[model samples]
Target: MAQGSGGNVIAAICNLFFPGLGQLVQGRIIAALIFAIIVVGGYALWWLVIPAIIAGVFHLWSIIDAARFKASD
Candidate 1:
């Protein structure tokens, strides 16, 4: 899929619900795992304000990353 395509839009929506899900949908297993681990781990430690903020940042990053992803030609 190209960047800014329908697939990217769907992936972005997926990431909106779950950070790593969009990467997974785009067939990027490593990115999906990394995003999932960081986001989920941070959320698990949400009692700490810093981690929670970090999680939120990562979550938005994940969404944007998925939205902007371009498949290699």
Candidate 2:
């Protein structure tokens, strides 16, 4: 909402639609793909269930990470 607000805020918001989307928004290509595999793959294998739940956790982590991401880190 401020002039200096970083891309992380935007990225985190983007993550709401899907996991790894934030990373993609932040230009974290590898992270995006990796997360996409983890989360998307988890959803694909819905029968397994456990991994999918874990992926949900990962998605939450992604949101937090994106919110805190900095160019330096």
Candidate 3:
């Protein structure tokens, strides 16, 4: 709740809304895009409950990692 937070919470929220967003915010574009593609592609191709669950778990992990990350000052 102060200045110089470096978008940690923002990254977490992004990751929560969409998996891989945290990595994107961390500047890991390739990793983020790849995961995003996997999630979307899996949904379109499989349309199974397992894929959705996995994606949700991954999203939650990304968000947690983002939230725990130490922002640059």
Candidate 4:
């Protein structure tokens, strides 16, 4: 999908609910896995505060990344 397409919009929305879910929808398996692992791992360690903050940053990054993804021609 091209950047700024309807698919990207959908992907961004999916990421809003769960980071990396949008990447999964976009067929970016590696990116999806990385985002999911990092974000989820940080969330799992939320008691540490810093990890939770990092996870939050990654969550937003995932959403923006999904929204801006442009498939290779």
Q: CA RMSD for every model? A: 0.6, 3.2, 3.9, 0.6
Per-residue lDDT tens digits for candidate 4, residues 1-73, read 9999999999999999999999999999999999999999999999999999999999999999999999998
Backbone atom clashes (below 3 Å) for every candidate: 0, 0, 0, 0
Q: Which pairs of residues have clashing backbones in candidate 2? A: none
Candidate 1: give the clashing pairs: none
lDDT of 3 at 21: 86
* By lDDT: ranked, best first: 4, 1, 2, 3
Tens-digit lDDT track of model 2 for 1-73? 2223567788888887888898898788999888878888887877898988988888888888778876753
| lDDT of every model, 2 decimals | 0.95, 0.80, 0.70, 0.97
Q: List the residue pairs that clash in candidate 3.
A: none
lDDT, candidate 1, 1-73, per-residue tens: 9999999999999999989999999999999999999999999999998998999999999999999999997
Cα lDDT over the full model 4: 0.97
lDDT of 3 by residue, 1-73 (tens): 2222557778778886787887788777886887687676655645687887776666566677666766355
Candidate 3 vs candidate 4: the TM-score winner is 4
Shift of residue 56 alpha carbon in model 1, Å: 0.5
TM value for model 1: 0.97
Off by over 4 Å in 1: none
Task: State in Å the error of residue 50, model 3.
Answer: 1.4
Q: Once superposed on the true structure, which residue ranges of model 2 sit more than 4 Å away at CA? A: 1-6
